[model samples]
Every structure is written in structure tokens, then in C-alpha cells.
Target: MTHIDDEPGTVSEPPRGGRGRRTALIAVAVVVVAAVAVVGALGLGGGGDEGPGAPPRAGSLVPVTRATLTERTEVDGQLGYGAEIPLPVKATGTVTWLPEAGTRAKRGDTLLRVDDRPVVLLYGSLPMYRDLGLTARAPGGAGDAPSGGGTGTGDGGTAAGGGTGAGAAGAAEGAAAPGARTADGGTGKAAAANPSASPAPTGAGTTAATALKGMDVLQFETNLAALGYTGFTVDEEFTARTADAVKRWQKSLGVPETGTVGIGDVIYSAGKVRIGRPGVRLGQAVGENALTYTGTARKVVVNASAAGASWAVRGTAVRVRLPDGTSVKGEVASVGRQATAPEGGSGEDGAGEGAATLPVTVTIRDQKSVGRLESGPVTVEYVGREVKDVLTVPVAALVALAEGGHGLETADGGFVAVKTGLFADGRVEVSGSAVRAGLKVRIPE
Candidate 1:
């Protein structure tokens, strides 16, 4: 056996056992060195070559695009019907009326029958009486006689009793007597005693004495006449004639010709109607002085105020972000004419008072788009000016520093300050000597 020493200067061989132990120790040292190298690489990998400190890596990015921008204003309002009318009970009778509620009536169609007996007596008596009295006082009591009765005078020139002195006296007495017999053997006593005896006059037809008036009524009447029911004549004043007209108008308009206009009844020109404020029901009592209808044009209006108002204007296009994450394009229809006081107070949070604003009407440029939007809280975005074909970067790519500026991280772990322009759609336009398209940037992972 040859004896070997492990020392370098000695050409000696070690025992097999020692050789195996040395091999095992070498393997352990190699593993320890590799682990140390890996830990060092992880800690120092983010250091940029440009400077001792740099922005962290960015995790995401977005692209820039060129598009047309439209300015817009935003407002809130409700959907409403164009027209409405209220029908009231004009005659004061139980609703046993004609032209059932909600039924269509035509011109001259019967609407409702009131206990017109009262009104007839109230209006008809005097005229009938006057005419009857005139007939009773006529000469020879001829008018007083029934229409078919013959005259009392004979063909002889001398009156049957006029030649006798007693006859003349008797005739004079007869005419003056409060109660006396007539030549026809019929009693003229009643007519002679009461010269003014006559039956009271009465009204005819199923019309109301009181009807609605004002522009609303006229508009309704005009519309009714146009519908081919011409029985009604428009007289600005609400009268029996007007009531009759309304009934006719209602029938033509496809509503119950109840002689009374009620809320929700379509009156006036077609498509130019109104919605009642309080609403109208069948059999509901209405009167000339009552508020029976509202025009379609009347509606609640809303406007923006504070910074929002200043940022928006009429005719400017805006996007309304609904709760569902969908968006609708709308134009600023108007600004308030007057600034209202803040809802609570003038504190920092208080809405300021009397902020004058102007009203703007936003015509629905696209009805389909507007239909998706509901009347409620929504986010509005007004498009500003646009920049085209410029160098840009994702907003996330830029790191905000303690200093007043921002810096971008380079692929090799270097940082550079960048000049930024308009920011939009998650990207910002940037200008810098070292910045270029397609350059890799580091952001926080």
C-alpha cells in the first residue's frame, strides 16, 4: 500500500474514506454559494443604471387614440304625456249620465242629463208668461180664445147688442168686470181677472249653463271641431254653449262627452295635449273654475350648479354614465336663469345662493339613445379638446415623486423626467428627449 499525504507539496495518496468525505464537503459549499448569488440578484435587480433612486416598475399600460370631441351640458327631467284634460260633473246629477265615462262622444251627442227641470223653471218661466199674457189681453178677446174657436162677431153691421143702449153699457161692464162670462158661453173670468196668467218658461237640451274658459278651453274646442263634431261653437267664455261644445268635443276626441272636461282627456290638437296634475277619474266632479287639466309642455326641470355648472354649457354634448355602467350622449339643454341659494347654508359645503343661470332646451337628437337613460343620479363627462399623433404613455407608467414632478422607469432600471400634456382615456401625452415609442418601462408589479 502506498502512503499518500493530502498536503500540496507532498506527493502522497489519502485513504479512500478521506477522499469520499472531501467530495461531500465540496458539494455542500457549491450549493451555499449558488443560494447567496440568487438572494443578491433579487435585492439588487430593481436598481437603475441612471441614478441611485428611480421609479418603481409599472404593472399595466393603455394606448392613446385620436377621436373627435364634443362639448355638452347635462340636465335631469322626467318623461310625460303631451296632453290631458279633466272632465267634471257639470249638471250635478248622479253619474247616470249619457255618454258613459271614457266613451267617445260626437258633436251634438248627449253627454249627461242633469235635473234640468230646476234650471228649466229657473230660466224659462218669464218668457212663456209674457207671451201668454199678450194673447189674453188681445182685442175681442180673440187672442184669449183657443186657436180653433170661431170669432163672436156676426155678419150684420150692427152688433147683436150694440144698437141697444143697455147692450153697450153691458158690453162696457163686461170688459171691465174682474170675473165675467164671454159671448161663447165659456168662462173668460179667469183670463179677465188675471191678465198676467202664464206658465213659466223652461230650458231645452242637455247642455250646461257653466263651462270652462281660457286658452285651454279654446284649444280644446278648436281640436274638437276639427274632428268632425261641429255641434259646438267656441266662445272663449265658459257658458252653456261652451259646455255643449265641450261635450261635442269630448265625443270627437274619443272621450266621454260628459259635458265636463276631466284631467287626462286628450283635448286641443292631436299630439298637442297635456297631462293632468292631480289626475282625473270617471264620475269626478269638475267645474269651470277648477284646474281640470295641464298642458304637455309643463314639466319639472333640473339643472346643474357649482363647479359642475361652470364646466358645462348649453348645446355641449355630454355622456351620462348610468348606474348599470352604460353611457348615453346628451346635450346641455340649459343653465338655470337664476342661481338658487345653497340647499343648506353658505358654509364651505353649502350650495351658494342666487347663482344665476340660463335655461337651455336640449332637443332629443337621438331618441333611441335617450330612452335608455333613466331620471336619476348619473355621471356626466364633457369632452374637451383633443391632441393627435403625439408621444404618449400610460398614466400608470409615470411615478409621482415627492418632488413636484413625475419620472418614468427605463427597461435597464433608469429614471427620466417627462414633459406631460393633455391626459385622456387613461393615457397622457409626454415629451422628452429619451422617451420614444415602443420603449419598455418599469412599473410596480
Candidate 2:
């Protein structure tokens, strides 16, 4: 259960979370085991359905008072690379050369060289599937990149890069775009062996190949545009410009300048990734598990309970407390709706049992906060909303009336109808004409 701290008004009382509060009357302290069924009732005020002031119950009397209320929840989280992602193999070919483990590549650099072709990296969330490039006979005047955005085609020369294109959040906009370099720093783009000549992929296909649909095609266009290839609009379908772009890309890459893209020609990823150990040695058959890469920057993930998920909302402000007692600022990057096992396999509610939680990803805005810390356990504190200077009474003081309303027992034993409001520190906000400072009300223990 999460604990709430109180801030009293005028009346002196120890704040539940430290920073006590003051109230005009007796320091009001209330603790309710059950959550208030209606929170909006606190905002509502009008004539009560019940008749004049009356005290019907012969119970203990508690005075109405004012105070500030806040709720705080603390949860455990781990600090480290946001998440580990596996770079899947998109092209079918023997691994010619793989970057040594720990070798980090920039966003647009080559992470893998398959059959001497470059598999470039970009920063984006969408995954590449189909082969990307232009067709020999495109519908629109023999040229253009995808419609969304892309670098247009160049004259069968060098595949240009750094072209401007619309960017998607979380998507890798690699600096090189596509077909810029191979593992050996060679352009797989062999300058058209003969000026006005086309190059080839030793034993593979070229841009003259047909383009496949899906996110894969779209990303390729985005990659090409980012690489400075413009002239065609970035879109999903292959166009003459895309083919021209492909030929130029191939030409610049030192490969056969075919105006088509093949599956084995290029690979797309989110961004340049530090190479992990190769799954297969050079010249080995490619497998499903290609390689894994982690985010260059560090981040933290919190497995929060469903009830506590509101604090972990996307973009919510967060304060991370590191093991060294240092504090850092961050924001919720993403929240997972899927439920997974809690810390203890059960939950924070009790002994390890049937407990599940929501996975929340938090990104550290300031890299300096992490300093030299690599990874470790950390604490996260969420500061929820605060209700201030409101008429408050002990939760026990509220009684559900039979006439479709809630009320408080007056000093004369008559019931004064009232509405409930923000609940905090076992105290609740109550509003009604019958409510006032020092007005005593009956409460059941």
C-alpha cells in the first residue's frame, strides 16, 4: 500500500510524509483504509436533498478543518541501457566481414558487410522488410524517391547522402543514408567501372530488381533521402528516381550499378550500433539471430503496478535516486500496457504470489547525471497532484445517507448532507452549507 503525507492548515499536526501541516482547528489527522468511491464529490456543492441541520448519530464528534494534501509513491527500478535489441539479418548471404565486438558505428555507418555489400544503419522505429530501390520503368517520368521524403537519384555517379527528409520519432536517421559504404570503408559502389557504365554485385542482384512493399520499402526511401539523395518524393512504391537513386547508390558503392536493390545489397537498422560478437564467423551461413546492440546512452526501466501506473505516465516528470545518493531528472519515455511478473514474482502487495506489473521505460535527459555509472539498482519517486486549503474532515466522519447522498452528523444529532472531495492522509474534502470550521461531526471508529 502507498502511504500519503498530510499538510495541515493553521492547526498543527505531524505531516504523514514529514513536512507536517497546520489547520485552524484541532490538527486533523485521518486515515482511511478504503479509497473514496467518489472524488468529484469534493468539487460539487449545492443544497442538500435532506432537510435542515440535524445531528442524528450519537457518535464521537470531530471538528471540520483545513489542510493541504499530497500523495507520494516510491518504486524500485534498474538503471542501465534502455533495452537490448537484436539486429536481424535482412539479406541472405555469407557473412563476409563483421565488425569486431565492441566496435561502435555511427547512425549511418555500416554495421555489417555481407557478400561485400553494405548493410547500413539508420535511426527509426519501423523495421525494414522488403528490398528498397527504383525500377527500370517507373510510372512517373522514370524518377523520384518514395513520396513521404527521400534523397533524389544522382547520375550513375556516387550515391549521395545527407539529403533532407521528414523524420519519425524513434527512427534512426543515419548520416550516410543508404549504399554509402561497405565494411572495408569501400563504397561497394565501384565508380561505374567505365564512365557511362553500370556496376554489379559480384554474384547477387541490383537496383533493376523489383521493389517490395511494407515498412521495409518506406524506410529505404527515408534512408536514401537522409543520405542526400533527393529528386524523388519519399514514398512506399518504387519509382524511376528510386531506381536512379539505386543505380547511383550502387555505382558509388563500387558494386554493379544496377538501377535496382536486392535483399542482399543493404540492411537497415535504427542507428549505428556497437557490434556484439558475431553469431557466425566470416564466410559462414547467416542465421536468424544476427547480432545484438544496445543504446549508446544509459536509461532505466521501472516495473510499476497497475494501480501505481498513473505516476509512470508517458512524459511524466521523474526523479531518479542513484545508489550513490545522487539525484537525476528524467521523463517517462514509454509505458507498456502488457502485464508481467512483479519484483518478487508475486507483487509489492504481499508475499510472492499472483502479482503482475506494467513495464515503464524512462530516459535520462541529462547524460551528465549518469556520470560514470554503468548499471545498478535505483529508486524512483513520483510526485502526484496536491490539493490545498480545502475543507477537510476525517474519513470516518462521512456517512452514506439513505437519500442518495452523504452527510455529517451535527452536534444536535441531526444529519447535514455533504459531498466528498480529494482524499489524503486519511482525511477527505467535504463541502456543503452544513460544513464549517469548528462544526463538530459524529464519526464511527
Give the Å error, residue 417, model 1. 2.3
Predicted structure 2: lDDT: 0.60
Which 10 successive residues of model 2 have the least lDDT summed?
Answer: 163-172
Please provide, for model 2 over 12-109, each residue's C-alpha lDDT reduced to its tens digit, 9 standing for 90 to 100: 23448424322211122122211232332332221111123353332567789887755445678999875556687777777887887667777557
Per-candidate TM-score against the hidden true structure:
0.39, 0.50
lDDT of 1 by residue, 317-379 (tens): 665555566665657665666555445455233344534333333334455654534244455
RMSD of 2: 20.1
lDDT for 342 in candidate 2 is 56
The per-model lDDT (C-alpha) reads 0.40, 0.60
